[model samples]
Target: MSLTRSQVESIAHLARLDISEAELPVYADSLSKILSFVEQLSAADTSSVEPMAHPLDGESQRLRADEVSETDRHEKYQANAPSVTDALYLVPRVIE
Candidate 1:
C-alpha cells in the first residue's frame, strides 16, 4: 500500500494541509510507510477474538441517581435582559 507523490498531494489537499513542494517527497514516503504498516496489521488473524465494549468487562460503571440538584433561576436571569418573550430572548433581526 505505497502512496505516490500525486496521491500524497491529493490527500494533503483533501485534509486542508499546506504541504510545501520541498516536503512532498518526505510526506509521500512517510504516508506510504504508514499505509504499509496498516496493511500488515490488517493481515493478522483475529477470527477467534471476541468483541468487547470495555477492556475491564468484569467491572460495572457506578452511576449517580438522576435528580434535580439546582433551583431554577430563569426569572432572575431574564430580569437583566432588555427584551424577552415566552421565556425566549429577542434579538434585532440582522438578516432578511
Candidate 2:
C-alpha cells in the first residue's frame, strides 16, 4: 500500500491540485497510510452482518405528506417585481 513519488504526482494531477516538491513526500506518506488502513478494514469478517440503511434498528425515517398544500401565487408575486418576462425576473445586464 506504499505510494511512490510518481503515484502521488499522478494523484495530485487527477485531483487538479498543485503540490510543491517539499509537500510531495508528505502527501505520499499520508495517502499510503490511508490506503493501508482501508486494506485492513476490508479484511474484517462481515459475513454474519446485516446491511442497514441507517445505524439504528427498528426505526423508520419520518416522512410528511407528499401532496401540495399551497396554491400557486406566481402572478401575485410577479406584480411586485420591477421587471419580469416569460415568468422569469429580468435584472439589468451587468456582464456585457
Candidate 3:
C-alpha cells in the first residue's frame, strides 16, 4: 500500500497539478495512506449485503409537488441581463 515519488508525480501530472520536488515526499506519504485505506475497504465482506439506493433506506428521496404554484417576474429578471433577444438571454456563439 506504499506509493512512490514517481507514481505521485505521474498522478499530479494527470491531475494537471504543479507539484514541487520538496512536495513530492509529502504527497507520496498521503497517497500511500489513501491506498492503505482502500486495501482495508477491499477486505470487507459485501457478498451478503444488498445494494441500496440510499445509506439509511432504499426508498426514493422526497420531492416537492411537480405542479407550478408560483409565478416569476420575467420583466424584472430580464432587466439585469447583459444582452437579450426576444425575451431571452443572448450568449456568445461558441461554434462556427
Candidate 4:
C-alpha cells in the first residue's frame, strides 16, 4: 500500500508531529512499508501456532523464600521532626 502526501500529512497532524515536505516522502515510504507488512502479517496462517511471551526460549526461574524482616525506627526518626508527639508526626490541618 502506498501513502500519498496528504495522507502522510494527516497522519503527522493526528500524531502531533511536524514533518517537512521532504521528510514527508521519507516518512510516507517508511509508514507505507510498515502498513504493508502489517497487511501481509494479517494474511499469514498461524492456526496451529502457540503464543509465546518472548521470542527467545527460556524457562522462568524461581527463588527460595528467604524470610528477612524489617523493623521501623519511628521513635529515632520522629525525634528529629519539627512537630511530633506520642510517636506521631504532626502536620497543619488544611480542612476547616
Top model number, TM-score: 3
**Over the stretch 1-96, how does candidate 3's per-residue lDDT look in tens digits?**
999999999999999999999999999998899889888777888989886666767365778889998798878899999998888899989798
Clashing pairs in model 4, backbone N/Cα/C closer than 3 A? none
Clashing pairs in 1: none
User: Candidate 4 lDDT, tens digit per residue, 1-96?
Assistant: 999989999999999999998899899899999999888777779899988777666755557688766588888888789998888778999699
Scanning candidate 4 in windows of ten residues, the lowest lDDT window is 55-64
Candidate 2, residue 82: how far the Cα is off, in Å = 28
Compare candidates 1 and 3 on lDDT and give the better one.
3
- Better model by TM-score, 1 or 3? 3
Q: Which digits, one per residue and each the tens of the lDDT, describe model 1 over residues 1-96? A: 778889988999999999999999999898888888788766778889887788788777878789988799999999999999988899998799
lDDT of 3 at 68: 90
lDDT of 2: 0.92
lDDT of each: 0.88, 0.92, 0.90, 0.87
Give the C-alpha miss distance for residue 82 in model 1, angstroms: 30
**Estimated TM-score for each candidate:** 0.47, 0.47, 0.49, 0.44
Worst 10 residues of 1 by lDDT: 35-44
TM-score of 4: 0.44
Per-residue lDDT tens digits for candidate 2, residues 1-96, read 999999999999999999999999999999999999889777879999977678767676778899998899999999999999987999989799
